[model samples]
Target: MTTQRTITVDQARQIVFDAYTTGLPQAAAAKLLTGQATQAWVTSEYAALRRRGIPAMSGQGSLFDPAAEN
Candidate 1:
């Protein structure tokens, strides 16, 4: 039998960040944090992190990066 540990959302978010710092993809981090791998939740949490000035994704559209000037 396995028992699931109860963790607050903040703790979960920190876990996600820690995973990212260790080179895990945001989706993977989200899965580890929530125990579920779903695009919807990953996307939502990624956006939340971005809103809080954290870059939760990679590439040119990264929220923490400056937008390229045209």
Candidate 2:
């Protein structure tokens, strides 16, 4: 059996955010980041970011770019 590495919520959010900004599909991003295409995990992280007032929309603009907000 292999040990699983634990990541903090912030780290998870960053990974998801990066994937989102890079236009990676949910399943593909999740698989690339965690070795499994768990879309639910990606969804959950997006929700969490939303709750924290972070902009996280698929195919939408990034949080750091004000011009993308339009």
Candidate 3:
């Protein structure tokens, strides 16, 4: 029998952030972050990340934040 480890949303966000900083494509990074290959899952995870203030890319602020554009 095998047991799966469940991570917190913050931990998942960190994983995605680190993956992006390493230059991994979003799709690949999402897969690594979520352990799933479905586009819907990837999209949902990205949206959640955005809502939590994780930038979509390196050296940039959250796109959903208006102040980030300043």
- On TM-score, the leading prediction is 1
Estimate the TM-score for candidate 3: 0.47
lDDT pick, better of 2 and 3? 2
Preferred candidate (lDDT higher): 1 or 2: 2
Find the candidate with the highest lDDT and give its number: 2
Model 2 residue pairs with clashes: none
lDDT of 2: 0.67
TM-score of candidate 1 on Cα atoms, chains taken together: 0.50
Ranking of models by lDDT: 2, 3, 1
TM-score for each model? 0.50, 0.50, 0.47
Which lDDT value does model 3 have at 49? Answer: 64
Provide the overall lDDT of each model, using Cα atoms, as 2-decimal numbers: 0.61, 0.67, 0.62
Residue runs of model 2 more than 4 Å from their true location after superposition: 33-38, 47-70
Q: What is the C-alpha RMSD of each candidate to the true structure, in Å?
A: 8.9, 6.4, 8.4
Identify the runs in model 1 with alpha carbons over 4 angstroms from their true place. 34-39, 51-70
